[model samples]
Target: MKHQTERQAWMEILAKSSVVNIERQVQTLGKLPEYSFLRSPEIGLTMLRGRAGGTGEVFNLGEMTITRCVVKILDTIGFGYVGGRSKRHAELAAVCDGLLQQNEWSFTVQNQVIQPLQTIIQQKQEQQQRQTEATKVEFFTMLRGE
Candidate 1:
């Protein structure tokens, strides 16, 4: 599902200000019956490629390790995954997902958490792109006469 404007605003506030404590927001949100079973993963899967040692074409090797988590509120579930090899994140996600499916946690989950996290991830990507563009450098070599 798409994120709401309020979620986007919150994410922007988070991105722009270090003074805004995320944990506080999380805690506040956590108290809501809608966000009781949310989980954030620590790692995820990345595509791996195989290439020759010196100079050769690259080939798709296989899927690399990953981690993921899920947050559930009522009928809504938010799944988060990161690229890397880590079992902890995957386990956390699984547990959240399981909790979401259980009868006890089905009615307390909130959908708001997904939007903020999604916004933060997008913002982080944009920041990385901006930083990369800002730091782009080029060098030219001078030719010498023998």
Candidate 2:
């Protein structure tokens, strides 16, 4: 269960990160192990669903384009799914996933690649939150008696 949670966290970070950011961080890892594609990167559409008025009935929001790839490195397999049609992004994500699964490379990959990417993501979220708060409005009522 712990292992699954850790993978889930890292995978979420990978999915949220931009391809350029991920690629930049990955470049610091030096030589990468050879990997073969288990499933070639492919683009497809997934239906998006949304709720009306936050808690009302759900409705289809429309379809979004996504690209997915699977790769095998040694005995472990990795999968990557990203929004849009960037095949290279999907491939790089798969490579990172595969490396993160191996005991020998997990620590290095997590520190050098995943941690920085996660930091960048957190910073962006914080900035957005601050911006939203800045626009917050407050309302009050004044009473008049006859």
Task: For each candidate, give its TM-score against the true structure.
Answer: 0.37, 0.89
User: Per-residue lDDT of 3-110 in model 2, one digit per residue for the tens?
Assistant: 568888888788889999999999999989899999999999999999999799999999999999999987899999988899998999889999999999999999
> Residue 123 in model 1: shift from native, Å?
1.3
lDDT of each: 0.49, 0.92
Per-candidate count of clashing residue pairs (backbone under 3 Å): 15, 0
Give the Cα error of residue 93 in candidate 1, in Å.
Answer: 1.9
In model 2, which range of ten residues has the least summed lDDT?
137-146
**In terms of TM-score, how similar is model 2 to the real structure?**
0.89
Q: What residue runs in model 2 are displaced by over 4 Å at the alpha carbon?
A: 1-4, 142-146
Give the winner by lDDT. Answer: 2
Backbone clashes in model 2, listed as residue pairs: none
* lDDT (10s digit) by residue, model 1, range 21-84: 3333345435434443355555545788888773698978888766666666556564535345
